[model samples]
Target: MEVTLLFVSFFTLLFIGVPIAITLGISSLLYLVTSGIPLTIVPQKMYSGLDSFVLLCVPGFILAGNLMNSGNITDQIIRLSNAMVGHIRGGLGLANVAGSMLFGGVSGTAVADTASIGSVMIPGMKKNGYDGPFAAAVTAASSTIGPIIPPSLPMIIVGTLTGLSVGQLFLAGAVPGLLLGFGMMITVYILAIKRNYPKGERVSFKELLSAFKSSSGAISLTFLILFGIVGGFFTPTEASIVASFYAVVLGLYVYKGLKFKDLPKILLSTAITSASLMVLVGLANVFGWILTSEKIPQMISNLILGISENPIIVLLIINLLLLFVGTFMETIAALIILFPTLLGVAVGVGVDPIHFGIIAVLNLMIGLSTPPVGVCLFVASSISGISMEKVSKAIIPFIICNLIVLMLVTYIPELSLWLPKFFF
Candidate 1:
């Protein structure tokens, strides 16, 4: 009955278009009211949720991403990518994927990736004679890599929930993220060739050298983050702070692109975005509390064990459940709520949490490109001035490519574990 109320209220509020944070908060609050729990607990949990030292990474990373944008990094990345790949057939589209992958290593947020890259690439692709929907599709699909790479906000949230090492999770994500990027590139190339899309001309050696030189300063942001994290120079959270500071210095002094006057707006935007996501985490923590109180995880574990003692079948079931849940719930919300339950189950089955975390995040990341809620899809459509219907149709093949990669990460634990084992 409690579980029923939880789901009923959550879905009801969600159906009525409540912001995800509010939906979660209200649903959990309803449980409190009906069950006669003291209201003080709400404030306590919400405050506690935001009190994590690790979570400080979220705002720092977000600000760093924004600062890098202000520093003219995206333009440099695009130029650098074009210099390398523009001579090939379907090169510009390939450049979009490659640029986003490189940029993803820096920004670590899908929405940021879509907005930053799409703002540049969509029109660029269109001017080059690529159809608008296809341009938007390619941009949207490639942007999913943002969170899957290091300095990811969602990984921080998930790590906070599951007690996994954020650094390990970040390292685990590298290969899968690259695999997704490469898969998207292949998909775009096949489509570009099939439709006879325009190819860019080869640049002269001098032109290539100039583009590389121009982009070198901005491109260094990626190296900064990768070096800091993988080199053990800092923790992931600490690395975010370092990255944010580096971005500011680069923007203000090096690039001279963002001035002192821009700090107010940038700080305000960072605060608001950080506050909103933190609220969702707070609400999810409370919701997770309610689920724990109701013995939901135990019930779920029992039910799964009853149906299949085999670890393989159990994992398969879990993968499908997460995939469907991905279609409906926000990824962060899903992560906080499901991680506690699923992590335990996976561990009981002798599956590594680090491996599962990568697969779990990649699966949900793809969901952001799926229908009914796909934030990335909406962002791309808005940027491209295309309709949702058109973008959805355009993204179909690319989504398939992503799903194939998701399956690889899911079934093959070595892909995720190798980097962390060797590097960490």
Candidate 2:
């Protein structure tokens, strides 16, 4: 009965358009009140959720990305991408995908990737004769690569929840992240051929070298992060701090793009974004505690086991469930609520928890591009000045491309595990 009230209240609040964090708080509060538990438990669990060294990466990484953006780093990276691939058929579209992959290494969240890259690419694609919906579709789909690469916010949250080696999880995502990016590029190539998309004249070798030289500082940050974590120079949390410090230096000295006056706006933006994420984490922690107290994880495990014990079939079921959940739920909230329960089931059936973490994060990242509640979808569609319905139709093929990659990551554990093993 208590669990029923929890679900009922949560769904009710969600359907009524309450913010997800508040819905989690209220639903958990209802479960506690009805069960005669003291309200102090709420504050206790919320603090427990927020008090983690690993989570320090959230603000640090967000600040790093924001500082770099103010420093004009994104524009440099896009210039490099354009020089390398922007002459191909669907050249601008290819540049969009390439830019997302580069920015993903810096930003760590797909929404940021969508907003940052979409603001530039979507309009440019449309002005260059690309259909508005297709442009929006490509932008939204490529943004999913953000969380799959290193410095990933989702991987950080996954580490906090499961206590897996955050470094290993970070490495595990590298191969599949590259795979997803290349897959999207392939989709773009096919579409470009079929639709007769325009292409630019090939750039001279001198131009490509000049573009790379200009973006070298921004590109170096990507290598800095991967090496810092992989070489044990610092923990992922500390790497974020290092990245932020480097971004500041580059902004002040190298690029001279960020000024003293920009500090207030940049700091305020970081504060607002960080505060919202931390609140969601706190509330989701409380709601997760309620579910645990009710043995919801065990119940879910039993339900799945009742259907089939085959690891392949079980994983397929979990992936489908997560894919559906991603279409409507916020990624972090869903991770906090569902990760442990699903992790337990995955581990019980011989799936590596590390591999499962990559798979789960990959699934939710895809949701950012999906409709109804896909934040990336909304961002892309709005920038393109089209309704979600229009982008939704155009994005379907790309989503199918992503699902193909997700399935490979799911069934082939080596896709995620090989890198961690090779480096370690």
Which candidate leads the pack in lDDT? Answer: 2
Candidate 2 lDDT, tens digit per residue, 348-396? 9999999999999999999888877788889998888999999999999
Quantify all predictions' global Cα lDDT against the true fold: 0.86, 0.92
Determine which window of 10 residues in candidate 1 has minimal summed lDDT: 218-227
**Which segments of model 2 are wrong by more than 4 Å?**
none
The TM-scores, one per candidate, come to 0.96, 0.98
Q: Model 2 — which ten-residue stretch has the worst lDDT?
A: 367-376
lDDT of 2 at 378: 91
Clashing pairs in 1: none
lDDT of 1 at 403: 85
Candidate closest to the true structure, highest TM-score: 2
